[model samples]
Target: PLGYIKSISFICYPFAYGNPNKPKKMSELEKRQIEKGDLSCLINNQQDANILYKRIIKLYHQRDMVYLVKPKTLRYWLKSIALRDANEVFRDLVNSGY
Candidate 1:
């Protein structure tokens, strides 16, 4: 009763208000939108993009109070940062979970 409610709330609350740094859980419609989302327009190919998205979702499920920073956010992280290719970030994601 109370324990069940507590357990359920623990899972549901975070699902509702996920970590601010990561992408929020997609509704069925949003998932479809992402599945059909312009892969070429984003980073890397569909497969790599999907893998990184899955990793973000996994992080959302596994950790508490963790923040995720996107590759683009490096601008804010370091104003002097320079990169030759943006896809390198997603490539790293494929090679390493981050």
Candidate 2:
């Protein structure tokens, strides 16, 4: 349907739209760090984790292709490690009242 096609197009178009001031691509290390951050926050259920995951995925690959895996695998991983780390940091932050 036209709506579906447009939805796909909307999702797909950003990789081609570059900001002139920004570099065309990020280094692999930078990308990995980003994914690590997302994983941490997602595990913790941090407020920004979903947004971070979406951005990190977008930075590295297309959204549609990323979903070929069984659903919820990434969520499980996030909960396992990243979430725990995020919770510890958040708890420290709150306890410190910073």
Candidate 3:
């Protein structure tokens, strides 16, 4: 029982408090694409955008402590950030003729 509790806590504690050392899932190419402002790799179409929007929400819900305290507020905050970032990326794509 003690071991089980330890293991569960180990898995859950990171979600309660952000993990600074968490490994990023992004590949090198993806990193490069983001840095270059070419988000085609991340969002190629409306479907991709929709999927990514959901993923972003899920990611924040799982990893952000603020989300645990206030789910609605976190959702709104994340939506605003996503919209701003998406607009910037879309502008870059348009300017680059993509």
Q: Give lDDT tens digits, candidate 1, residues 1-98.
A: 01111121111112222345654443556344434544323333246634542112112333322122222332433434323223443454457655
Highest lDDT scorer: 3
Give per-residue lDDT, candidate 1, residue 18.
Answer: 34
Query: Candidate 2: lDDT over CA atoms?
Result: 0.32
* Residue 97 lDDT in candidate 1: 56
Candidate 3, TM-score vs. the true structure?
A: 0.24
What's the candidate order when arranged by decreasing lDDT? 3, 2, 1
Give all TM-scores, in the order shown. 0.22, 0.21, 0.24
Q: Identify the runs in model 3 with alpha carbons over 4 angstroms from their true place.
A: 1-77
Question: Candidate 1: minimum summed lDDT over ten consecutive residues — where?
Answer: 1-10
lDDT for 24 in candidate 2 is 41
The TM-score that candidate 1 achieves is 0.22
How many clashes does each candidate structure show, in the order listed?
Answer: 0, 4, 0
Q: Please list the C-alpha lDDT of all candidates, in the order they appear.
A: 0.31, 0.32, 0.33
Give candidate 1's error at residue 38 in angstroms: 1.6
